[model samples]
Target chain A: MSMFWIHFKKEMLEAARSYKWIWVPAVFLLLGVMQPVMMYYLPDILMMSGDIPPEAAALITVPPPEEILASTLSQFSTIGLLVLVLSAMNTVAGERSNGTAELVLPRISSVLPMMIAKWAAMMSLLILSFVLGYAGSAYYTSQLIGTLEWGPMLGAGAFYIAWLAWIVTLVLPLGAVLRGPAAAFIALGSAAALTMLASLLPSHLQWSPGRLSAIATECLTGGDPSAWAPAVSAVCFMALSTIAATLLLKRRPLLPQA
Target chain B: MMEPVLRIHNLTKHMGSLTPVKGISFNLERGSCTALLGPNGAGKTTTLRMLAGLLSPSQGEIRYGNSGETGADNQRWQKRIGYLPQYPKFYGWMSGLEYLIFSAKLSGLPGKQAKLRSLEVLEMVGLQEAANRRISGYSGGMKQRLGIAQALVHEPEMILLDEPVSALDPIGRREVMDLLDRLRGEVTILFSTHVLHDAEEVCDRMVLMVDGRIAEQGELSELRAKYRQPLLLLEVEPGEREADWLRSLPERHFIEEAEIRNRAARLVVQDMDEARAALVREMADAGIRFQRIEAGASSLEDMFMKVVGA
Candidate 1:
């Protein structure tokens, strides 16, 4: 168990030293800061136009900066998803390609600990990025539109982001078990295919990890916390996927001689 | 008797239709350095990897003799085994010290202990000066040394090094061999190499593999004694026609090929003493002035070829 923490700490250090933490959140911040500001000013700029037609003027609703900021926060939070995918791309694929996995595996006995440690480290980074993005937009919203209700919803939404981070963590074991980027793509693509399949099913079959994105959106819109059942299902998929990946890895050579 | 540290029974591996290693079995005693010697394409690497637990044999099992009965727990046994592959890469972003520390941590050491062990191992591999440097800046030899350092950091009871010195230059090879020499009393090492001199330098006993089987295996001195062949070559004065006269000697069996090579004559004899006695008398009687007559030392390469038939 201590070994897991040591590996996790080292992984976190590596991520920090590589400045991955800075760049992932910075990209999201750019999106976050822009989303609300864009929403707030675009209507005002259009209203100032002498060419504004009478019929189209009715469609323009100049929301306060807080509403604009909230809408912007939602759009930019999608960037958090991109950060998770980018991080996963490097987590398993880069290590296997560089032969670091071979150097690591023989030292450690079980694939479970190694994969679990790595997953935790990556999830920590993903959650950190999401919180930073939300906080950046929240600060802007406060300065521009004064205080508002539903500040607690931001915390719940951050937890939702964390649960999704755990879902991506499931990719590491599959990456380690299978060789190369093709395996990474196939594993992630399988999850995407599952999501698509669930979308096609009737509402009865819709309660799965596949609906996490929609569940996340609902949580952001001040929906009941109980609506997070689908995201909770995603956690179950994470556990099952991690276990399956470990077993699959045990069957194949984690490190073939160069 | 102290049980063998490692025991293998009928280990086999096949690549498609071709069997690379077929039912080869061997045992190693504690603190013994055994070299797995073979020509390229022989199953030496495959067998070493199986012992390292990096490769699974298609048939048969390898048991690391622990306290429990056979097939009880592999994880406990694996913890005691260390493996250094032929080509190992570190996390490029990591400093050499960080890489070693990470390896130690993976081997179940806690934070403080892992760092301490990593420092000791880096010093052991003569990389302490460069420990803070990124792994990407390290040369091939430095990377090789780091691989050794990482493998030994956990203080494993047994270590498998595949072609450890194969990438080193002559001086680097000597340094690595000297290091291995020092590790004699500390750990049981199973080193695999195609380089004959490396095996000759550090290995007490060796298994020469050929076509997925043990062609020969024993103490170095024993192999030397068993395959001893006494042959003498003498170079005579030019224009003396020593080849014809030497061939006519009663007790000497002449090598016509050596004789034809510029006033040189070769003699093959079972017993060196008897042949020398006969050659000296015949040379004096025939007034043959030869420059050299010396005993030939058989090399491991020669022994390998003779055992494996060319």
Candidate 2:
């Protein structure tokens, strides 16, 4: 096996030992399932409150299955993204501070492969958690609400995953320089700021990866958002950050400043 | 004649305001255990870090290979060396065997071979019994032995250890020292320590550093002969007569330097016979009660103190 695989496997083992693999996916699955379940029960809940008028009950109709799934994407944008940032905050920063990087970095020689392995390991967890949660949300939406097409659902999930990946990749470069919580906070803050800026002037900033969430919503709700631009931008952002993170790690491979 | 496995030329590191190693150069002969001896803050750790590529030198080149040939850049040559920092921290979640295997694999050993070598080294470091236990549960000495095992797992040509036994208790120190003694001729070992005795215990050569400078470096036998000096130690009864005599001992032409305390003195003498005779004569004339008097040669500890104090 290549050195990358070796490091990647070690990461996976650590995730397993720390229960990140289990808890992260479980959190997302609950979030995804909660969205559709609440949508179906909101009208009944309003009626049972007794302070609500009959007219309010009639106005409260359940949203479509696609809309429920899209709303689930919004749920992910808040809690899901927070969970991801928290879980991955220490991937590099903790290694350095805990002094494990001092032991491992010297043996590897080049920092690039180690950085890439870290990215790949985090990606595996991210992809697994998102897919499992999206599937849970989709299953409930189809059963409780209405029929949905698989093609649009997959496309929507794909675009949103790319957006999530942009934020995830941002953590690495930041973690290479800063402490864990600081890196996580900055990454999530930048992601939120970028999303707001992109939405404020959609036509001017449509190329930003931040627009991916809205594009995912559009795809699910049966509107065609622009293609190839945001996708290419996400790839470029990841490439640049990986190189920058690798260089940062090489410059200060040890914690406590050696 | 055999060439050195590593040649360090002008290895220097400047950490902001202070320089740790100042253009120090030396050659590490193949299969020789050398100690980078220094006190705290003398830049021993910094030199080791630069050698391990954990820190980049401000100005210097670490040519890692034989005397007549320089093999590769830092990145390529890193595989030929293993390193253990002062306090090596392993993944607390990983078992001893798992951590060693991870290190071996990262050094480019294949899966099966990495496993075999990891197990082999675990046994070598006396960690085979605890190979399956988490590193968090290990005692201080066990952790250090595991650190050595990780450095040796890949079978690197040379191992660089920074203060390997300084952080350990006496038993742990002995364990590591014994292990190092067993490894002396098998690999080229360069380790740093503030304790001269630790260096003398296992190392054949010494590189003494003082204030980031190479104060002295040479083979053990050569240094012992070159720095050989005779000394006289005397302990007299506490009295005014003895005190007055000890005060005047430094003025004697035969005594080079005299360090007088309450009722005792350590004199570095030009001629042991002449100084001993003069001291006995002065004591009898002064009517001082002498407890014990001994003539001896100064050890390397004196050399260390004198060089560093200079």
Candidate 3:
């Protein structure tokens, strides 16, 4: 729809002007590149620290490129997810609080297109940062450690992105009802709880989207873990959250609280 | 009556326990500029928000044009109306030109037409020179002008502005008021303001609201004549004797209401000529050193004060 594009273009322009495009990907890249380089230089870094003797330092062995990339995915799950959620937390909440929505909402009959455009814009940023960071980590892993298989590496990246996608999408619905930082905090907390639940009873919660992280790591290590259940659920979760955000926004378009 | 451009029947909004807009209704003519005049917390903003479709009414209906159907869920009416809040805020990072284009596009204007209209409205609001400048750097007046421009960019059938000039400096107020004056008859406008002088200056009609209800609404001329009353203003030299004479004048048979402050006394009287003659003769007999005496009709301000105070 043309309306979606118009709003999407505006969102992207806002992202650019706010320097989100620069710092977000840059943070991801730093997080990604740190994983493989740190693993490769563990012995030397330990030696320079003067905390370990030479014989103990010699015992440190470099990890395989697949394992190193999997470690990079873990890093993405922590600091990288936090950065992405922070970037997206203000998408709707900021507009509502700053009084911009009062000017913008009356022009359209429904809030669906605006919600979709915002979600798409956030997704675009998420994919861009994730691709750049994952690629940076892959390139560093192949050079400093061992060559990675293109097939499994791309699959692992896709799975990891899906896992991050659903978590970041939580901010959309949460932001509609709560303030920005509160939304971000709740989204992150939900992700932590879901992942813990999945781990505690892996058989019972096999369909949980939280299992995507582990599935991604398995794919990278040459294990063909089942991805269908979590993938389908992650996509459904995203669609439902977007709809929830649209409905909540439609109910109270002007002020967020009352 | 060419079927009023918009009609509302007992619209109300209940926010939690506070009902800001109690059930009230009014109609707007096709090209008339009507002011929604009220004191603060009189539900002007809540009413405008409901008509603008930002907030759904808890009761009643909004009908647009000749159609009997409610316009609440109609996209056609949504595209035909523009709204500016009491505090109009924009994306500060966006340039004025960009914001206008964005707004016009959202109103369903095509890309080329949106751009052209954006430029036209920018010039109309006297912001063409600042089109490329970011809005955050704009002065308060410039921002208000841009708010008006964005509201006009879509060429909607009507615009609802809440307290449009209430927050401006004197010069800024003058500029916006003049702009509204120029915009009269070109588009229907329903703007809310507590300043009666503003409504009197450019609006042809007024809907004076008090305590979430319309106290009075009619053509400006009709309300002026309806509220018009004989008034006598007498100013005497300051003295205990003159003050006593001024205070005693209020108790006279012809005087209906009186407000005496220091050396001046404003008396509302049944007969202006009789009151003037009696006051002049009394002051002369009492040897009162009166500086000035004037007879006139009361202003709309008195009606406004009376309605709001009640």
Candidate 4:
């Protein structure tokens, strides 16, 4: 446990020094605010472009706060998830390639503590960025569109974070075996494929972690979707990936392979 | 005799099709400094990596300490070791001081002791002024110094350094060599280097490796005395007759081996006095216009070339 803290502190320090702490949250905040603001001005934006008749523009109704917030979760699913994965993609791969692992791995008996610490640090970042982005979206939606209940908003945010967390966690295992950019690309690609599969066969894939996103959106729009199966599966996926990463790293601690 | 601090029994590593370290075994005494000497691709790095516990051996075992502990008890034993890779890399975002402290802490030092040891190693490596600066901006020499500092910060019982000073400038090399000299009695140091001079400067024992095998290993003086032979270096005025005479000298009864260039020949002889007398008399008879002839004992460099070249 003490060893975990030592490695965790190092990971946090690296994140801070690299400005990952700042830029990742900033990108999330930008994505969060853009959703509600853009939806509020869609009618005027169309009229100004002169692409739609005034009658057609008037027919465009601003989405409710719940719907706007749900769309913000979608934005998080795409760009926000990308930013988080990009920030995390190098966590293990960079250390291995740059030869830092050669220096550190021998000091500790097992790689499990270090892997756990890294995962915790990444989780801390993901949680911090998600909370800020989702809060900003809720605040903007309340002021520009309509009022929202804190109960559903917080619950929906939790579900969305779970969805993002599992996908981003894939980078850890992938990064153990591949380069940083390749890990990030495959992580995002897997998330897309899983989501597509879940939608294509919802009855068969109800427990897919990909369903958390849709469940989050449903929770926001006042629909009570069953969140247990997807949330539990997301946690399982994260845990399994973290273990897989640890095992892979232990097998080849200095993986600078091209 | 006390048990060796570390022992290896036929350690081997097969990475894909290339077997870098092929069934090599050696033991390290508790406080002695040994140099792992080898030419490039001699598996020095691979051997050091296995000893450092970074790479698991494909076969055989590495036993540590007086108890002859093996991999099952690695964590406790690993704390007693400090390793520096050939190209030691740190988090570039970290300052030299921070990296040292981190290393010390990871080695199981208490927080306060870790800080004090960090500062001590920083001063020892002469990185006190640049301790706060990011490592990304450090020069190669400074980084090398930091590598040494981190290796010593924990005050481990043994240190495994892979090519510790191979990348340094002359002055940096001198400083590191001096540091290793100072560290000799205090800690068990096993450093690998192809340069025989560096090993000769500080190490008492030498393990010469070639092609993933131990070509020769023993006390430095013992190996020197064993391989030492009477050598004759003859440099003559450039001429076809002189070159022919130099070539012909190797076929003499007293000469064991001959390396001939256009105007120079290095002759290893079976008997120094007989070879010298016969060569001089032959030169006088043939009227060979030789510029210089010197008889001396062969150096370790010659043995290194012989081991590595073969």
Per-model tally of clashing residue pairs? 0, 0, 0, 0
lDDT (10s digit) by residue, model 2, range B235-292: 9988888888888888889888889998999988988888888789877887889999
Q: Residue-wise lDDT of candidate 3 within A101-167, one digit each (tens)?
A: 8899998877899999999999999999999999999999989888999999999999999999999
lDDT of 3 at A70: 95
Report the number of the highest-DockQ candidate: 3
Give the worst 10-residue stretch by lDDT in candidate 4 chain A.
A249-258
Per-residue lDDT of B1-310 in model 1, one digit per residue for the tens? 2457888878999867989998888888888899999888789878877777666789987878744546546666777778898888888788999988888877777779989999998999899999999988999999999999988988898899989999999888888999999998678989999877889898888988888988888888888788666767777776555767755543445331233355665554577777778778978988887888776744667778756665
State which docking tier applies to candidate 4.
high
> Any runs in candidate 4 off by more than 4 Å, and if so which?
A48-51, A256-258, B239-241
Where model 1 places Cα greater than 4 Å from the true spot, the runs are A45-58, A62-79, A138-163, A177-180, A202-204, A219-229, A255-257, B1-3, B15-18, B66-68, B72-74, B234-269, B273-297, B307-310
True contacts kept of 1: 0.68
Worst 10 residues of 2 chain A by lDDT: A249-258
Full candidate order by DockQ, most accurate first: 3, 2, 4, 1
Once model 4 is optimally superposed onto the true structure by TM-score, how far is the C-alpha of residue B253 displaced, in angstroms? 1.4
Give lDDT per model, in order.
0.73, 0.89, 0.91, 0.90
Greater-TM-score candidate between 1 and 4: 4
For TM-score, candidate 1 versus 3, the one ahead is 3
Q: Where does candidate 3 stray beyond 4 Å?
A: A48-55, A256-258, B71-73
User: What's the lDDT for residue A86 in model 1?
Assistant: 60
lDDT of 4 by residue, A1-258 (tens): 999999999999999989999999999999999999999998878888997877788889897899999998889888888889999999998887777888998888778899999999999999999999888988999999889998888889889889989998998999888889999999999999999999999999989998999999999889989889999999999999999999998887886441
